[model samples]
Target: MQATRMISGRAIPWGAKNIDTDIIIPAKWLKTVSRDGLGRGAFESVRAVPGNIFDVPANQGAPILLAGDNFGCGSSREHAAWAMLDMGLQAVIAPSFSDIFSGNAFKNGVLAVTLDEVHIARLMAVAADGAIITIDLENQVVTSDRQDRFAFAIDPFRKMCLMQGLDEIALTLAADDAISVHEARQAEDAPWLVPAQG
Candidate 1:
C-alpha cells in the first residue's frame, strides 16, 4: 500500500449508480492474486463499447474518479480496489459507497470520498471539459477548477492507515512490542499452560 495524502490529476467522471465489484474488475480477472495487470480488466464490459469513458485518452492515468451514488456495491472483493490502484486511481468520489467496498478500498490506500449529490454533479460537468481535480485526504476536501469544492468525512483510524500506508498486517505488527510483553507475562504466570510438543 502507498500513502494517500493528496492526489491531484485529471478526473474521470463515471456517472453510474450501483457499480458492483464484478463490474469493476469482473469475475474472469480474479484468478491472479497479483495486483499487476488487473487494470487491463477494469470496467471491461463497459469499455468494450466504442468511445467509452475509460478508453478515452484524456482520462488515461487519471488519479481521481468521479462516480454516481452507491458506487462499489455487491461482492466484497479486495481485487476491486487492487484493480483501481493498478489503474493509477488514488481516489473515488461518489455520493455514497457500499460499506464493504469502502473498507476494502481504504485498507488498500484508496480514498473513497462521499460527497453530496450537488457536488458530484458539478464535478461531473467539470470533468466533461477535462478539468484537473485535487483530493486532499488529510484535509478531507476535494477541489477542482471553477472553484468547485466539497468536504467529506472519514474515520480517523482509516485515515491514519491511508496516510501511513498501513495494511492489516502492518497494523498488527505495529503492536508487536505490546504483544511480546503480554506473552512474556502469560508464560511467567502459567509455565505448564504452554504447549509442550507440537
Candidate 2:
C-alpha cells in the first residue's frame, strides 16, 4: 500500500447510485486470487455499453471517482477495493457508502470521502467539465481549482493508517520488537508453556 497525503487529478464523474461490488468488478473476474489485472475487469458491465464514462479517454487513469449515494452497496467482497486500486483510483467521493466496502477500501489504502448530496453534485459538475480536483487527507478536505472546497470527516485511526502507508500487516510488524520481548519474558516466566525442541 502507498502512502497518500494528497491526490489531485481529473475525476471520473460517474454518479450512479447503488453501484454494487459485482458492478465494480463482475464475479467472473473474481476467480483469481491475485489483485493484478483487475483494472481491465473493473466496471466490466458498465464498460460493455456503447459510451460509458469508464471507457472515455479523458477519464482514463483518473485518480479520483465521484459517485452518487450508496456507492459500493452490495456484497462484502474486498475485490471491489482491489479493482479500484488496479484501475488507478486513489479515492472515491460520494454522499454515502456501504460500511463493509468502506472498511475494505480503507484497509486497502483507498480513501472514501463522504459528503452531502449537494457537495457531491457540485463535484459531479466539476468532473463533467474535466476540472482538476484535489483531496487532502491531512486536512480532511476536498478542493477544486474553481474555489470549491468541501470538508469531510474520517476516523482518525484510518486517516493515520493511510497517511503512514500502514496496512494491517505493516501495523502488526511495527510492534515486532514489543512482541518479541513479550515472548521472551513468557518463555522465562512460564517454562511449562513453552514447547520442547525436537
Model 2 error, position 143 (Å) = 0.2
Structural similarity to truth (TM-score) of each candidate: 0.85, 0.85
Q: Each model's C-alpha lDDT? A: 0.88, 0.90
Point out where model 1 deviates above 4 Å: 173-198
Which candidate gets the maximum lDDT versus the true structure?
2
- Tens digit of lDDT per residue, candidate 2, span 1-198? 678799999999888999999999888888997878888889988889978897789998999999988999888889899999999998999999999999999988899999899998898898889889999999999999889999999999889888988767877899999999999998899978867787
Candidate 2 backbone collisions, by pair: none
Residue pairs with colliding backbones in model 1 are none
Q: What lDDT tens digits, residue by residue, belong to model 1 across residues 26-98?
A: 9999999676889889888998999989879999889888898889999998999989988888889999999
Deviation of model 1 at 85, angstroms: 1.3
The per-residue C-alpha lDDT of model 2 at residue 102 equals 95
Q: Give the Cα-based TM-score of candidate 2 against the true structure.
A: 0.85
Worst 10 residues of 2 by lDDT: 162-171
Off by over 4 Å in 2: 170-198
